[model samples]
Target chain A: MIEFDNVSLRLSAFALHEVSLTIMAGDYYFIMGPSGAGKTILLEALAGLHIPDEGRILLKGEDITGIPPEMRKIGLVYQDYSLFPHMTVEKNIGFGLRMQGLHHPERKKRVDTLMKKLGVGHLAQRAPLTLSGGEMQRVAIARALAIEPEILLLDEPLSALDPIMRDFFVDELRELHREQGLTIVQVTHERHEALNLGTRMALIRDGRLEQEGAIDDVFVRPRTRTAAEFMGFENIIPGIVSDAGGPDCRFDTGTVSFSCSTKAIKGENGAVCIRADDISVREKTDPGTDRDNTYRGKIVAVNPSGPMVRIDVDIGLNIVMVMSRKTFESRHLKKGSEIVLTVSPDDIYIISTGTPDTTCS
Target chain B: MTSRIKPDLCLISFALVGSTLVILILLALLNITATQLSDIPFLLQVAQDSRVTDSILLTFTAGLNAVIILVLLGTPLAYVLARTHSRFNNIIESIIDIPLVLPHTVAGIMIYLLFMQRGLIGAPLKDVGFIFEDAYPGIVAAMLFVALPFYVDTAREGFEKVPLHLENVARTLGATRFRAFSLVVFPLSIRHILNGCILAWGRAISEFAAVIMIAYYPMVISTLIYYRFTTGGIKESTAIAFLMILASFSVFVLLRLVTRYVGRYDDRV
Candidate 1:
């Protein structure tokens, strides 16, 4: 396991503020954040590029914070692929082996194995400058893996590729992780990439790590208002908790109350975080008995969101719901249409309970 | 009619002004060659003359040696300047460019004060039997002093073009700082370094006032041409001048070709 104990570093105009995280062995860990969020800085810190000003970095329980990158047994790949333009594909792949003092024959064998594995063996004699983007990316990855690092740090590895190439590399990365059993830390801002590949992930904002946990927990249940927004929680309704004696509780929003299952206690001031995809909309009909957390509302707006359609509904409070284009078209929904919105009790996540300024709205 | 003619007039004037230097140089070279082509035997004799050939060879050799030293020592400084951003580095960059802006005579005088016998650096070297008074060392010192900025500035630009992440990746791949530089950064910047060396060498060879100030004997082409012009009149100096122009142009063209060939891979990406 790798651990960062309250690491703080100050770069020009940006700083990572007492950020700490633990990445376990064999975990595909992703560091996700917005641009200039210090995600790359944390990855670089793990790669030993930047030394923390006030903390310790431990690798397998050893304090390797002060060690140089060459001795860290870690590999880093950048978004641009940073292949050695002076060397051919084969030579680029063999560079790390040569640095590690491997004999020529053994190095050649290992390079050939990695090249074939990464599907760039045919371009071995060609210079990196002559290779395609995908080809160069594979060569760079092969070069890093030739050293057989214990941990590989990738800085937006797929952000440079086109959509199709990104899909291809996503699968390639998944297979590489499974085959090598290498602990990988990837930095990205794309939520789907993180959800698809990461077993565990961290969310960062303004240089501070807001939350970190298993992918499902962090995505489904964020712990802060900022984390909820970043994790795509579109509905954050401030309210007070009541009826907290059982597995479910009532969230009284002063205007309306929502039945939610949460760990929050009675009289706690918090907000119910709900993903846009969780709230479903249907045509309003006669009042039904299954109206636990359902409400009749009017569609205030209909906005197309790529393959999904976002409908803003006003049920005494503004709430956004997203559904697939097919489902939206089947419902024939539009602005001013009357609809009923229902959210499961399990989908409502209580966040920032009892925090100051979290007044009921 | 005026609107249509305005752009045409601007284009013609711009083209004329831009081509003026090329036109003047071509005319001068043609005039010199035309005057000398009729006297092939005399031209051949000038080429065969020991004084002319030896002076030309010495100039080329000294310029080449100066460039070699600059490449060896200036490369690291150039790399450092390229990778670092600070007030101190800015000061160092301005100092490196001092030779570029200084008058050639002032540069010569500076070199003379620093490296002349009984001077600051020359005094200690003189005690160790390394004299710089009217010697080969003095000629090279003057050349190096004047050509320092050409090599360093060009090499620094080349180093700057290479992304720093390449070296970082190399370090993570188990290479030390030096290895990363030597294997990754140096090879990528070789074309720039070579171009810088060529430019410095050209500047060194063409130097006149500086070399004359420090070392007038063991004449370089420029100094030899000056001495011949002062003592032997126009006819004698013209032949050497034509030869020197022809030789320098040929070498300059050859080096440019080599640089182009080395940098052919640059545009592939």
Candidate 2:
């Protein structure tokens, strides 16, 4: 287990503000944030690259805040792979073993094992500069795992690859995690990657970790408006609770209303966080009467991406809904078509706006 | 008519600049070859002379030693200058360039003042049984003082080209700071550092004014050529000069070929 206890660092132009996190043994954790949100800094901190100004870091319950990177027993893989340009693939993979004073024969055996495991044994003699992007990535992973680190920190590892390669590597990484039960901490801005690989995740914004929980929990129930927004909740309708003296309250936006189940009092102005995937779309008259909240809206945009299609609907206010491609094709979604979106009251997450959106003013 | 005149002017400008460079280099080559032709037996006599041969070998030895010392001491300073972004680093970097712009004779005078007996550095060194006056140490010190800026500036450029994240990643991969530098940073910047060493060594070999002040007794090749010119006629001096040119050219070509072979991993790496 790795624990960061209120780690704060004041770097130039950016500061990590009181980031506390814990990664359990065998956990596949991801730190998700936008560009320049200090996600890389957090990963570097775990790798012992940046010492925190205030706080203690514990590795397996032992305080290791002052340990140098070489003694940290944590491996790091960067987005560019950062392979030793001077060394061939075999030498690059064997570098850590040499540093550890391993004998030549043993080092060679271990290097060969990792190379074969990562499927780069054939390119052992090839220089790192001659390898393709995917090949270099494999060698980098092989080099990192050669050390047999307690935890591996990956900073945007798949961000450089094409979509097909990204999926292939992501699957490979998932398989590795399951087979080895290695504690891995990967930082990424790509939401799909986080959703796919993350067993637990932390959402970071403006250098502050806004939320941390199980991956499904953070996606389904983001605690703050900012967390909800960062999690790609498209229907962040700012509204106030009315008729709130019950299990379900009517949250009314200036332009539309949503029935949400929350303890927020009457006249409490807040936002309803709704994931696009939770809001299901159907033909105008095809919906059964079971949905607690249903609204008829006109489709304003149809965006089909891979397996899912995101359709924006204007129901007094615009709300985006995501469905599988098959559903989209069967319903024949198009702009200007009328559709009914059914969103259950339980799916509508209500939270304070955290900070007002003052940029427009 | 204006467009036609513009093309004509552009063509004339290109031809003028290109021919000037080509002609100047050819003129020097023609002059050296003509001098050699004037004294074919004299060239062989100069090459065989014990004093001339000793001076030529000594010059190369001292210049090679000076370049080695500069790499040992100046490389870290160059790296610091490349990575630092402070006013103090700017001041230090500017100080490093002083040798590049100072007059060679004036630089020699300054070095002489600092290394002479009873001088600040010389007194301490003399006590340690290492005197510089009239010795090979003095020769190398003078050469190093004059040639270091070339090595440092080129090395700084090389260090700047390497991304800092590469070193950071190496550190996380179980290597300490020095190990990472030796395994990653040094190899990536080897080509530039080698180029710098060659430039510095070449400058040290050709240096005469600075070396003449501190250590004229040991008689480096450049100082010997000067002495021959003052005592003997132009024919004698020209023969030695041609020999020195041939020696320096051969060494330079050999070094360049080695550099190209070893530093083959350029942009691809």
| Number of the predicted model whose DockQ against the real structure is largest | 1
Q: What C-alpha lDDT, on a 0 to 100 scale, does residue A265 get in candidate 1?
A: 73
Q: Candidate 1 at residue B191, lDDT? A: 91
Flag regions of model 2 displaced more than 4 Å: A280-291, A294-310, A322-342, A354-361, B1-19, B82-87, B266-269
True contacts kept of 2: 0.70
For candidate 2, list the clashing residue pairs, or say none.
Answer: none
Give the range of the ten consecutive residues with the poorest summed lDDT in model 1 chain A. A352-361
Candidate No. with top lDDT: 1
What is candidate 2's lDDT per residue for B1-269, written digit by digit as tens?
A: 35543468888889998999999988998898797987788889878999998999999999999999999999998988887677698788788889889999999998888887777787799999988888898999999999989999999999888888888878887789888877788888988999999999999998999998888879998889889999997788888888888888899999899888775564564
TM-score of 2: 0.90
* Poorest 10 consecutive residues by lDDT, candidate 1 chain B: B1-10
How do the predictions measure up, each by TM-score?
0.92, 0.90
**TM-score, first chain, each model:** 0.93, 0.90
True contacts kept of each: 0.82, 0.70
